[model samples]
Target: MAHASTAAAEDSCPLLLGKNKLPRHREADTSEGRVVERIADFQGPGGIIDLVYSAVFTRGIEKVKQECLLEAGELPLVPRNFDCWLCSTELLSLLMRGSALGNVGAHTAEGSPNTTWDGHNTIGLLSKSEKDKGVPIADALKNPLTPVWILHGGDHFTVAWCSAATPAEPGSKFLLHHWNGLPPGGPRLADLEITAIKGAISHGTSPSKFYKPEPGEIEEVVQADPDDKTDFPGQYRKWRYEVMLAFDRPDLQGEQRPVDALPEPKFQQEDPRYQRPGAWRCCLCYDRRFKTMDFSLVPADSPDWCQKCSRSRKECGWSLWIPFAELPPKRQAWCMSQYAKKIEPLLWTKWPEAEILEVSGRELPDC
Candidate 1:
């Protein structure tokens, strides 16, 4: 990942790489408005840089522009000689019709980048307009040429144009993403009278400040039996028992006490040889006397095994695992059923009894 503030410090054309880079031709190449040219001089007052950025864009809705201008009235200003930046590509998604969060990346020479679908993408680089929502309106409208519009009732603002090549096409619309400042306004943009624009904005707040109930909110304490083999003892015993009871298994019918819970797993840790990152053998599949390692170069820590053996290294001096793909259907079914049956008695102590019954494969008679 590139460090923040690097582009403007050392490069000539901060928008695009290289010296004398021409204004981007494809409107799609820019964020909100395509930044065509930028000239900065470090000779300004006390060596502070004086920068002027030239942006170009296709025309857009007058109503939207007006709304944005009105909202812009509330934003604050950037200190002199400082460049405050915003990009449309980052802000456009937030300004769409619904509160639906759209996925858009920054203005890379090659459009927004493809992203991973694993749901971890949270970093965002926004256009100056989007950031303007946090400050006063006057501060948000630093650009002189681009048009501005306001959604009348309040601080909501939208830029006049999206950019030249990627210009807001005829009938193209923007989201009220944010306001840098109250664009010479009164109520916030969310209070604007624009038709069908209500309830679309959400007041921002910190999630860490929100309240959450303590864990096991409804459980009660229960004493453990003296003969119980489970390691759990005393005061916290009931919570363990409740969890054991809540274990969902189709073949199990009654409540499972802590003892009936699955035993703490015993990992193979004693032998340094098999303890390598990818080495592991299932206790139920092999018959060797000295644990033969599966030499497939599989990561020793992988959860899957190549083969199954019927004995464990500790108990029978050998360990094995049937390759997962080759396991007989009947054996796999039997293992699943056995696992389910083992946990059956522990179902439903904390959850509603109805849920427990559904999981236990026991249909209740109609009332």
Candidate 2:
């Protein structure tokens, strides 16, 4: 009798259907009278501006508020005076099923209509949890059809997609695209190498090899800017985390090796500043001009010096040059405090076992 009652309850459930009896929820109504009507008016490829506007006006605002309360234990109240920055979860939802007209069916690991890559959320790729699952940064670059979104400094969002660089060799590079809402033009595009993207994820710094501009490039880029758009060559250096989208394709294989091993940073030991057991040295020339600048004259409070380099203060310019070991405790405390809010959370969450104490005390590990 108990078994018969259980079967009856399952049969009556609205989600169960067909001979297979698979569980499936009903799709949100996208009829003529709803938000879909407004979204339908937009034609062609819409960028982040389009995505955000459609999402907020439709239902994303309420959805994000509920999710924030459930996950973070606080409501994200939007101020009437300024625009609110949406989190990765809310942004992913807007791309996935936020609107009938703009819907790309983009799938994510943490948001509603949850989809997993290899049984884990794709967003995990940006965090320490990615050690176990999700698509590898290498494989994502190889496949041209895949789209990737990157979250930086917990505040900004950028999109990337693979495209053929030339007819001779298809899928040669990935285009780093950004949407400028202020100018009212199309998305701006830039070329990004696969190796550089991998390196940035592994090491915390943007590899200089990828972002270093060629001669005359900076001048040409400066003249073309509208002031609202970011400085082209410099923006690549600020990335913090990335997420791979699983929309329209699910069969892509994820990397099995540890996330840190994707590509060991080639330049970690090139400069002494990044090294442990830091020593006092001229900031301008590293060790090249150590004899020219006297460290003994520098005050304990203001370690920074101007016109210290006797050779040419005009040529060398004014820059604070102090070794990691010689930095005053107060300055050291200030440096640590800045990282506390944004970078510390990433360190603790992604690498729980890491010794995150000051560089003076903690031993440098192989990253």
Candidate 3:
């Protein structure tokens, strides 16, 4: 990632690596509006760097949500139930509507002096945007003009994070679980929205942030119980159990116990190998010992995402994921049935659209 101050502190572009080194798609190669563009110099919080890094590198939403609280201490806010980051919306769009990055790499002038990666196909996404929604108001195939948009950008990639729990229904298993009252159809472009964000740097990724892994290191780094889900970062699992316990004891909108009073996690894992930058593994998919890969080092076009997650149209992202695909068919159905249970109250108060998942949570007070 480039200097946060340089990218977000000011409006001027901070030409990154291939900013000027690569040739711009000649004006002769494009039309107007087809090369749609929106730029913002964010000035909100400084925690966005880590946030975007996680999403672009394909970190699952569950882990991103955990990091929001544990890492940033709620600085970025855990993207309320329905909302999501502008960067996530952008990357999701690229994955869903835009041409695959592999099909969109740049063409060098024969052997124009270049290093490893020159044709910059990166994208700069503000964390917040009021005007970014649209199934696909625009895409790269139509707009090949500038390699980098504005100065805000990150290594372009995709991600998904899903989970499931035991079903509540007696039968009717073997089907995927979807949000209650969720449209049987796909999400419209309008759902993504168009909004402006502050306190975010568009260029939020760098090569140094990624580290290549040694052979067999991937499997060794991923520790599975081969039973229940893997444990959270040391002490976190126990801490989370306590948090839920605290929440359940409180009455509607009542003052809960002080978080500081909560007990520290009883267990912690301290493996130096897994702590390295880009030593990322799919925490959502533990059934199979998937190979771990460095997200930052890989080319923009191809991501080593889990085949199962990819098949589920995971590009929709975490907030937007409707039916949980990570779980087995029967398991996914059971979880959805739970969400469907006792959801009558929320539909009248909230967006109602995204409130289905909350039914599985504590009873929300009517506002």
Candidate 4:
């Protein structure tokens, strides 16, 4: 069963089949649409994004936000971004207006109920007993957006349709494992997205048509950002959650919201009031050393100052990544003391030259 227009309805768009046919449940019965029936197979480093790599939409949703592609988010495709100040709707306002990452405190507040940060639905991939609050599963799949919800489970990802599509297989709401970024059924939602973009371009559709951009248009569109509203990656650091799972749990939010998590806590901020000894030290540097940032995403060569957040270790409270292996022996010892219980063992067990960071993050999803 199928309903609603293709997110990008025209056959020129990749969301549709060869003849502009929507991905109806019956299509899975054929050879062409069977790709949607496969599963994602991911393993090891770089997470799901690594396993399902594609150059078209490189950098995952990040590139999409930083560039233009008006048709990127149409009927079946849900269009939204948190840094609207950077890019509004379909325009490519990628110029770093200010700090690369700096924004109001409640950024993650932009999290939506039924959709993942990238517009995926978790229904079929979630456990029956899972208590995570979100839009109803069955309805999420049959959205005004894409009929297919390229969902992400903990370890792996799945490309699934609504109940009307077919059997979810016993003991689960999805079908088999992901196909390792293969044709038809892709390994990650990003892969599927890029595939669609490629299909659209192959038809000779002008690239500029989809990601149209106009000078000064971004500032005009995002001018009236309401203080209380949010978009993708809202309150991300505050909530200590992944972008995919970050916003769906708005009810979990409370008074802990930082009155102003931005402005980089400069020497002028009241919260980080000037003090003799404290004022001289860089809190951002201290935090990165103590593992304040999400180490999983942090780069070994991360700079002392963050271009996104527009802050440096000089701030009262900020963080970044560490090249633990590259740090001087004394510096390495200090960082180890912070996450001692987790990585200290590496000093003893692993090879002296091993890339110890391989252990900090999540395990690969089993197929």
Query: Which candidate wins on lDDT?
Result: 2
- Which has the higher TM-score value, candidate number 1 or candidate number 3? 3
lDDT of 3 by residue, 1-367 (tens): 2211221212223243244533432331221112122112222355354435433344345544454343113423223343534333333322322211211111222522211122222331121111111111122321212321221112212111113321223221221122211132212111111111121111212112112222111211122222222443221112111000011112234233355643222111223322323212233333232353332222223334445445321221111111133222322323332333222111111111122222234322111
lDDT of 1 at 290: 39
* Ranked candidates, highest TM-score first: 2, 4, 3, 1
lDDT of 3 at 37: 23
Candidate 1 lDDT, tens digit per residue, 1-367? 0111122212333554443344432322342222232212323442221221111111123333333334222111122222433322212222321111223222222433323212221222222222222221121112112323221111122321222211122222232222223233312222111112111111221112211212212111112223331443221212111111011225434343355543332223243432323454332222222355432322355445433443333432223222222223322332222222211111111010111122233321111
In model 4, which runs have C-alpha deviations exceeding 4 angstroms? Answer: 1-139, 142-151, 160-164, 167-367
> What are the runs in model 3 whose C-alpha is more than 4 Å off?
1-201, 204-367
Give candidates' CA RMSD values in order: 25.1, 18.6, 24.5, 21.0
| Residue 185 displacement (Å), model 2 | 12
Instruction: Please give the lDDT score at residue 165 for candidate 4.
Output: 35
Kindly report which residue stretches of model 2 are placed more than 4 angstroms away from their true locations once superposed: 1-36, 40-64, 77-145, 164-187, 196-367
lDDT of 2 by residue, 182-283 (tens): 222223333322222111232122112222222111101001112212533222112121111111213434433354533321221123443222222233
Q: Is candidate 2 or 4 superior in TM-score?
A: 2
lDDT of each: 0.24, 0.30, 0.24, 0.25
The Cα error of candidate 4 at residue 80, in Å, is 24
